[model samples]
Target: MVSVCRLVGLRAVARHAVLVIALGTGLLGAALVALGVVLIFATDVATVYFDWALVALGAATFGVSLLGVFGSKHESPPLLRAYASVLLLLLLSLIGAAAALSSLGEARIDAWMEEHWERIEATTLVVRKDQFEALLADHVAALLTLLACLVLVLTFDLLLVWVLQCSATSRHRRLRGEDVERKPLRASNGAGVELEAVAP
Candidate 1:
């Protein structure tokens, strides 16, 4: 009885955790979509291709969050597993992209920024080349701070994914345990003997 109560409590806690993960993922998706929209219309920092990628990523994230919600509601191990796997893949891809970008070094990043600034300056009279160069000089510290924040956020996301996976695994184990328990109960009731007699 104690083990059963403990199992129930753990299951409840796991369900609540999964719900929180779904909410977090949904908010993340909405933020990404909003950022993409803002960038596409109000800023020249991102190209059209990059803007679309952000929006697509947001949509996929929101969809996965919905999957997690349903999975948790139904206590379906398979759906939860699928949700965790897709989220893990997305996180890994983001990490890889970040790694590749960082490996390009400051010179490559500066060149890319200069190229974009020139394109923006050509199209608009608001920003001058000298002013942009000065701005870049001043923003180096800000850029580094942003990089640090990104690392922290990635670490937090990894922990969230780990929690989600553990919840799925625990649910699966509970299901298997229940099945095993039922098998012995079935034999204790002599149902197998009855079935065997009928078969013969």
Candidate 2:
């Protein structure tokens, strides 16, 4: 009984955690899409493609987050698994992006920065090429750091998926056990009547 109660508590906590995460992710995704649209029209950075990419990624994130929200709310195993599957794909994409960035050379980075600098120069306080290089390096480092953090978070999410599955399985097993116990009681009562009739 204690163990069952503990399992219920853990399941409830995991479900709430999933709900909170889904809500937060959905909000972040919406913000990203909004920012992308704003940048698409406002920025002179010739990064229209990048902005579109952001919108696409954000839309995908929002969709998956909604799936997770609904799955947890309804306790639907298939939806939960589908959410986990999309998350895994997202995680893989991030890893691939990180790997591609890792191979970026200093010259390539400098050229890319120079290409965008003219449009951004007026807004940025930076004047020297060296300053631009430094800022670019910092940005790359920050991106790598953020990716690392995301990887950790996604790993935790995978664990949460397992926990949710286990909770569901255990709950189902408990209900079946109760049904089995009731069946035996009925069978025993029938057997007792039969024995009494045979004794007569």
- TM-scores, all candidates, are 0.54, 0.66
Deviation in Å, model 1, residue 152 alpha carbon:
5.1
In the predicted model 2, the residue pairs found to clash are none
Top candidate on TM-score is 2
Q: Give the per-residue Cα lDDT of candidate 1 at 14.
A: 56
Task: Give per-residue lDDT, candidate 2, residue 43.
Answer: 74
Clashes of 2: 0
- Candidate 2, residues 15-126: lDDT per residue as tens digits? 8778888888999999989988987898754353667888887898899899989987776778888988887887898888888778876678777777987766655333
**Model 1 Cα lDDT, one tens digit per residue, 36-142:** 89988998775646777898989888999887787777777677677767756766765675676667766886787777876666554355677776786677667
How high is the lDDT of residue 14 in model 2? Answer: 71
For each of the candidates, the C-alpha root-mean-square deviation to the true structure, in angstroms, is 7.0, 7.7
**Location of the lowest summed lDDT over 10 successive residues in candidate 2:** 191-200
Q: What is the C-alpha lDDT of each candidate?
A: 0.69, 0.76
